[model samples]
Target: MRNMLITGGAGFIGSNFCHYWAEKYPQDKVVVLDLLTYAGHRENIQSLENSTSFAFIQGDIGDQALVEKLFTEHQINCVIHFAAESHVDRSILGPDAFLQTNIMGTHTLLKVAKKFWLDAGVANHHFHHVSTDEVYGSLTEDAPAFTESTPFAPNSPYSASKAASDHLVRAYHHTYGLNVTTSNCSNNYGPYQDSEKLIPLIIQNILQGKALPIYGDGKNIRDWLYVEDHCRAIDLILHKGKIGEVYNVGGENEWRNIDIVNLICAKVDAAVVASPELLVRYPHTPCATSGDAKSLITYVKDRPGHDRRYAIDPGKCHAELGYHPVESFESGIVKTIHWLLHNQRETVNQ
Candidate 1:
């Protein structure tokens, strides 16, 4: 059985991956290392605590001592590195944290992995780095989607830092012979996401009858991927992907920002109508009180260096690894809404 270390396992995508992995590979040992930052919540992985094969450690990936300890204790042979300062707005406000965490932290992990796995002559270890599509920068309305070979043209501090980490992973493989694979994914939206993200923020604001803020004209587009599909893609990569290769994982479901907000509003409205109990739970919602949730849409100034569009071409992954997203945007959003509705108290507290 594979003994794995999953960094940022308390964060949205990471936590979802942890749950998916634990369920699918119960015989394997899973160790989670997270810094418990603003976005990472212990509640996300509390359910996994009861499992005998799972362990959670509250720590930073940059802490070399702590990382080494875990690797030694757990006999970690596979690492799914996901811990990074991921918010673009936060990165714009404070770029230093992004550099420290994304670049330095990744380097530290690479160092530890090399020492323990390569220096020790372990031939079965793998390091998989999770990254974002923003590293390819913006695309014009009709430009082709970003492929694995897309040159890095990162626009913001966040994407730039991610690009740096991606390069470090690649360098570790080519120069040091580290068995590594990287997957750069599109915008992911699903359960357990922090309220700061667009989809979860919109859903929470609609439930509270707060203004739904849209940046610029909200025409900027992003390809949305269901988190579970991403987990599955990574699963395939771990088992079958070529070493030292990069895969672009995406749902291929592109939607404009305003259009997504409108869709969520409509879906929430329909949900409240279908289940009257939701009206009682979220009485402040415009949808619950004979008003459309769309009435609360509010436009605001756009952030600096905001990319106009990002889409991913998953053709390589499909042809090579048979990777395809199973959830449609509609179904994924519905699942996210339903999850937030039941877990609103926990979500708001987070």
Candidate 2:
């Protein structure tokens, strides 16, 4: 049985991957390493405690000694690197954490993996790095989507750090002969996602009867991948993908930021049984007693270096690994809204 080390396994996509792996590959032992940062919550993967196939450790990936120790003790055969400072706004406010975690932490993992795998004479070992499509920069209205060959032109500090890590992983493969694969995915929205993200933020605002803040004119576009679909694509890449190759995973469903916010407002209002009038604190706000969540939409000043659009061409992943998303934007948004409401209900009940 293989020993898999999943960094940042307590975060949204990473925790979902932990659940998926536990159910699909029960024979393999899973070791999750997370530093319990603000974005990483242990409760996200608490369900794994009942399973003999999973283990969680609280530690930083940048700690070379700890990482090396885990690799040596567990005989780790695969590394799924997901620990990174992911929020764009946070990165803009302070890029140090992004650089430290995404770049230096990745370098640390690569160093340890190369040393342990080579010394153990482990064959067929794989190292998979999770990344974002923002590394390709922005796309215009008529421009084609980002492909594996897209030239790197990262716009934000967060994307730049991820790009650096991606390059390091590629370099390790070429120089050290380490089996490596990378997947640059589009924006993901689903259950267990931090409310700071677009979809969940909108949901939380609607529930609290607060203004649904949208940056700029709210016309910015992004390809929205369901979190579970992303997990499945990563699984396929780990098993079927060729060594030293990069695959782009996308939802193939593009939506403008404004349109998605509007969709969530409508869905949440319809799903929740509470009276809209009672939820609102100020009647002058957009969210009055009209039972319309769209009333809450308020445009604000846009942040610096906000990419106009991001889209990914996943033709290679589909053709090479037969990857196809099971959820469309329409269906996925509905699921996300329901999940937030359900969680909110559970919290209130407790």
Candidate 3:
């Protein structure tokens, strides 16, 4: 492709994809459009400032007139859609924004892209929609991973909205012969990620000697994929996967919530050589108990509509695109902790 448009490229995964695509295809022009909401950060792609092949536009993908204008003015040959309201807790507090940006926003972009593709002809363009495994709904730990054929049973407004957008994308491909491919991926953790999510939240709180809260019994499980690996999988699917097909991207890394927290504590302790910034001990707090960070464990009420488990069956992408995750949970977790350590320190005085 000569020119590509990536919506929400300032957000976590989108920003990673932008860097991935720019470096992979240096000759192509890459434009990033984002609304710069709370989760979208300009600093993520700040390093791209001097790259002539990269450009950033501050705007919402839901704006119809703006989307049409981009299609016409850029002569965009392909689109990688990543914009959406993604946090489950945020969606619970405000469902309207989720519906507007996730479903309606995707619809508007797809419509404009369809018109452009038809005018430009078929063989040279594509619309790659990035989505989440949450769209497959929660599953029991004993249940098999959600495959491409898994039936949708979204439990939260966030996942439901994504499912709605997925359906719209499917309809466009089937009814209009639009070349489309969708990927439903598991949880992603890496640098430049917003701190509101679970991993970063735990890192921030634990580092500050705050309680490491886990909801309910903390048995909820999720397959975690490193952001870089996820971007690699998306790149493969975009260039090689079949049209009108959905692929599942997973790391095969699963851990119980409490286990993850405890592991983080151990790793942080091993990594820290100096006294913590803040550590309160009830004068009588036993040295043995106070020394271990796990003493700060606290359980809260379970989240409303929280999924019990989510795992992805990536056989389709593995067989077709020859994709494989490079990091094991142990290795990935260490790298994540190191990055969090350095990043938290970097942002401390900012």
Query: What stretches of model 1 exceed 4 Å from their correct place?
Result: 346-350
Clashing pairs in 3: none
Cα distance off (Å), candidate 1, residue 297? 0.3
For 224-297, candidate 2 gives per-residue lDDT tens digits of 99999999999999889999999999999989999988787777766664545334423332345556778778
TM-score of each: 0.98, 0.94, 0.93
Clashing pairs for model 2 are none
The TM-score, computed over Cα atoms with residue i paired to residue i, of candidate 3 is 0.93
Residue lDDT tens for model 1, 1-350: 89999999999999999999988989999999999999999999999999989999999999999999999999999999999999999999999999999999999999999999999999999999999999999999999999988899999999999999999999999999999999999999998898899999998999889999999999999999999999999999999999999999999899999999999999998988788788887888897779999999999999888899999999999999999999999999999899988887554533
- Residue 183 of candidate 2: its Cα lDDT? 96
Residue 133 lDDT in candidate 3? 97
Runs with alpha carbons beyond 4 Å of true place in candidate 3? 120-122, 274-290, 345-350
- Rank by lDDT, highest first: 1, 2, 3
Question: What RMSD, rounded to one decimal, does every model reach?
Answer: 1.2, 2.9, 3.4
Residue range 1-350, candidate 3, lDDT tens digits: 46888999999899988887778888888888999999999888888868887888899998999988887778888899999999999999989999999999999988888788865675678899999999989989899999999999999999999999999999999988888999999999887788888888777666666677899999999999998899999889877899999999999898888888888878766665333432231111122234766777899999999999999988888899999999887888889877777766344333
